[model samples]
Target: MKKEKIQLKGITWGHTRGFVPMVATAQRYEELHPEIEIVWKKRTLQEFADKSVTDLAMEYDLMVIDHPWTGHAAAQKMVIPFDDFLPETFLEDQRENSVGESYASYNFEGKQWALPIDAATPVAASRPDILQELDVLLPRTFDDLLALAQKGRVGFSLLPIDVLMSFYMFCCSSGEVPCQNDEQVVREETGVRVLKLFKSLADHIDERFYAKNPFKVFEDMTQHDEIAYCPFAYGYSNYSRQGYARKLLHFHDLVALKAGDEPMTSTLGGAGLAVSSQSKHIDVAVDYARFVASPEIQETLYVENGGQPGHLRAWKNTQVNALTANYFVNTLPALERAYLRPRYDGHLHFQDHAGDVVVHYLKNGGDERAVLAELNTMYRESLAWEGVHG
Candidate 1:
């Protein structure tokens, strides 16, 4: 007697980079296993970041999730750890070849919660043709960025979440990391300086960007000609690929704070594949995740289909580089040094709300110290939920 076919469903964020590869891989997987079928659905990018994993797990067999939710996933057991199901040798290979901290970010409480299928960080992007036509060099320092913004040629995403990420970047660049202790996000001195620096550029850029995210900013840049340069946005390889957009964007490292300082450290932004604990077919889900995250698949089908692969093999693959105009190679350094966000159970509370506080200050020119105090309050509240909930 023949076995009955099994079906699985997965959820990923909406976007070619986030959605297409999963669909392609699922189709291929079904071809390889005639007894199985996989369907993929997508949510808005913001929803992908904000939705509760536990809720999603109830509906899907697989989830593409942000690393910051690992703590909650681990505490609630909403997703099973790959460590118990995947082979040690395979896990070891993932660790050895991880792009920066990509592999490590999903391991919480000593168990691998997810397999990083993509890796990204904010990197500089520009339309080389536009920059050349304008006879302006790409900005290399803070002052240079300000000068370029003054000319009304720079594009940046200032959405509340983006504002929070930028605040983290400025905090780190100013020689302090945010959310180090339970008491505060950062020292008042560093927080104040970072906000002031942020305000300087926020004051200059076009006001329309305050409502945009990286996707919209990239769309405006590629579809229209107004944005010649974006100093920092999550690097989207699709924008750089031939025929993927109306115009090609060349990506590069971020500008330094000073002429001699190191490139700015941006917040990490990527998605990982996790098996839902609620899945009826746990073994099948894990198998599919492993196949998707494998180097051979990631370097070839994944990248070719618009996915920004998390595997280092893909990052260094010549064919992958050729496909996306070396987008991986150009932005790898930023991913390597990217600051990992806090994942302690309730950190999402802060991630969700703190951005509003930062954005408000940037737009209203309020007291920086007061902003820091409010952020500290939020930080404490997030920490308070640490061990209390799933």
Candidate 2:
């Protein structure tokens, strides 16, 4: 009697640098479990944003979903909770800090919808040689970043969604809630200040220098050496693995507001694996999910393939440590402290509105008060939809 072959199909959004390691790991898993055939369907983040999971669920057995999508997916009953299928040992072996207990970013409504596949923290990537040529110290505050932008040598990238999230972090650090009182009063006081800061940076820097896509910023940093420093999402150890090797780009942990301001904070980002509720091959999918969470696979795939390990233990591997070096040492601690975005089903809609507000304020030079008022209205509508105030 021969064992039956299991074919697992998956869909992932975002073409971030993290994909390399995941694809590599899938190939390795195929070698080990010859009976398991894995097929991956890739989609741009925009394509995923344009469609709902319900429309695409039948195409893939496993989906690499965004953190914000979990609530919506769960509400639609599109994903299966892992508690019923995954073994206790599998959960026990996961990096304690990286799993549900410590990293609560991936959990919602007391159920774990997905296992974190990679970890990302926003950091500043700079051309060390350019900085040395300019003889400027690493920026330690948003004010310092503004100064760098003013020099007309260093550039800043403008990403609407990330900038809005970063504004949330800034406001929270300042002890102000952008969405306050169970989403009743949309407080734009803190939001306005954050946008003002961003506007100042934009005004000081050459508009031509702002890159819309982060990958373009990375490429410019490596190829043209034009940007001295720009805020970026971390976990690109794989990109640095080749070509320039050790000399290309340097990673700086996030910058705080000021010396006395709260510690710098960022949102937890990157993809995670979720089993589809509609899949008939639930057992095989669960096994594959467990295998993805294993330390051996995480270590080999994450480090060799350029994906950031969602397992804290894998982050401690000697090779990974050497590859990431101080970058991880300085950044992972921050990721541990990072906060998650709103976990409501309408998170995407809220993010879209917030992003539009940021972009509008930056481009049109409006009073932060008006923009924030509009943002608060949007948040209220989103909360109404989710039935969760605030």
Q: Which candidate should be chosen as best, given lDDT against the real structure?
A: 1
Could you tell me every candidate's TM-score relative to the true structure? 0.99, 0.90
List all candidate RMSDs to the true structure.
1.0, 2.9
lDDT by residue (tens digit), candidate 2, 1-390: 998788888887546454555577678778988988888777875565446676666777888776777778778878888877777667655536482233455577877788887677666677778889999988888777878877765554466766676676666666664555655324556666767776777776555544445555566667775578876453355444446343466676677778766456765676678888888888878788778867777777656666666777766677776776455565666676566667678767777767767776787797778787777778778878787622
Give the per-residue lDDT of model 1 (tens digit) for 84-107: 999999999999989988998999
lDDT at residue 17 of model 2 (Cα atoms):
50
Candidate 1: C-alpha lDDT: 0.92
The alpha-carbon deviation from the true structure for residue 242 of candidate 1, after best TM-score superposition, in angstroms, is: 0.5
Candidate 1's TM-score: 0.99
